[model samples]
Target: MTDFITTELHTARCLLRPWRTEDIPLVPPIADTRAISWNTSLKFPHPYGEEAARTMVSWSQADAGVDKWQFAVFKDGQLIGGCGTIRGEDVHAHTAVVGYWLGVDWWGRGIASEILAALVDYMREETDIEQLTATCFGWNPASRRVLEKAGFRNEGVRKGVVKKWGKTTDLWVYGMLL
Candidate 1:
């Protein structure tokens, strides 16, 4: 995957693009705060600082070609959240893991679904990736619905696969094949 053909991506209400320094301040607290911690795989104690965001921006840039990317999800000219793919080492292979999260305040407004849909379209058109996979805690019905609505099919549970806040969690695996 030389790149995901990221010239531009547009959803009905959002735009996805590369991250910038300006977006740092907006992203940290959302990850640090307890509001969205459990819903994401982001490491905890996000520190709400510039360093982390810079690191992320750098990674997104350096890894852009191989299916690793971080697109800033925006609406109304504001940073709403971030979404991207964690490209597998095999570029010619048609697959990658997808992950994303919105600010707590932005939840339940169809934003996540919209973003996911746009990403799916972009991936299908921009790369040879035939499979996009995602995981969500079993108890998180909202996330499950979002993935299903985005055309992901439920696979199975990975029991006790994630440990957050000192508790083990079972994750439901889902995938969409193009």
Candidate 2:
């Protein structure tokens, strides 16, 4: 199993903490939009609801502050987004995949950029991971921008590798070494 470094981190305008059961009630209202799910991942489908939130929170609750790296992003004590890492095992144990998402209402405020930078700094300082990776669909320039602003390099792209919403799209991969 992979080990995580910390449970909580703070950016200038957000507080990132481990997921809580209480957050189950807050997730759907912010995460159920097609706009978010379409660009994020298949795991987070449109119309995401309490059950998905329960699973996400439960997956992190037991491992919070110790083993799991995913965090719930909060602004002024309200759940606004999430950011975290998934560490690789076996020969890739020194690397991790990073991801983050925010509610639609909060877009374009530099929040994700700030949070991503802070998460990268935290991982570099607190974990054994040597490399960090992030990916965005070809249509997601906003996500690409966030990753680039966090000092990640556009390592490469895989054309037509992602099929989402019945359409094939490219995948842009970014990486940073700590």
Candidate 3:
């Protein structure tokens, strides 16, 4: 529960750093795809616009430096996606839920898997979190694969856990206990 400096996290393909005010404009274009929103939680809305971008950036900026757990993913100086961790409180404070997304153009390039593995390692080595978890829509096999490749084990599945786009779906939960 004490502060630990995070600075920037890096993978072979990209850099994960704190969000900036300038990134607000760049998010809408990359995040406005139904394909991306379909697999993610409702928090990431389809037709993602400037207002949503502003909210995302504000959340990242509100936290302390390097310690800002949310990160903007950049490759070659351009924003390509984003990732972050949400730590649980109370009895689950040692656990953190992880999430990430890449632009459609960045898909099939293994960027998410690469950055995700790195993020897990960073959190394990740099922070107080001891358990990391991620959940994907059961129909999203690609995301399930990414989580597996990053060393997460499928914990279980919860049926009727997510209602998105007017359809109810199962949620596949994955976790890594460090």
* lDDT tens per residue, model 2, 1-178: 2234235687889988767677899999999999998897888877898999998888766645344478899999889989888877788878989999999999999999999988898888877779998999999999999999999999999999999889899999999999
Q: Taking the tens digit of each residue's C-alpha lDDT, what string does model 3 give over 1-178?
A: 3343346877887998877888999999899999999989888998899999998888777754333478899999899999888888789888888999999999989999999987887787878888998999977999999999999999999998989888998999999998
Question: How much lDDT does each candidate structure score?
Answer: 0.78, 0.86, 0.86
Q: Among all windows of ten consecutive residues in candidate 1, which has the lowest summed lDDT? A: 41-50
What lDDT does candidate 1 reach at residue 148?
92
Superpose all Cα atoms of candidate 2 onto the true structure and report the RMSD in Å to 1 decimal: 2.5
The list of candidate 1 runs beyond 4 A from truth reads: 1-6, 42-45, 90-92
Clashes by residue pair, model 1:
none
In order of appearance, the predictions have TM-scores of 0.88, 0.93, 0.93
- Candidate 3 residue runs with Cα over 4 Å from true position: 1-6, 64-68
* Span of ten consecutive residues with least summed lDDT in model 2: 1-10
lDDT of 3 at 121: 79
Which segments of candidate 2 are over 4 A away from where they belong? 1-6, 62-67
Model 1, span 27-117: residue lDDT tens? 7766556667666766424444667777777677775745575688988987878888876665635688998888777899999999999
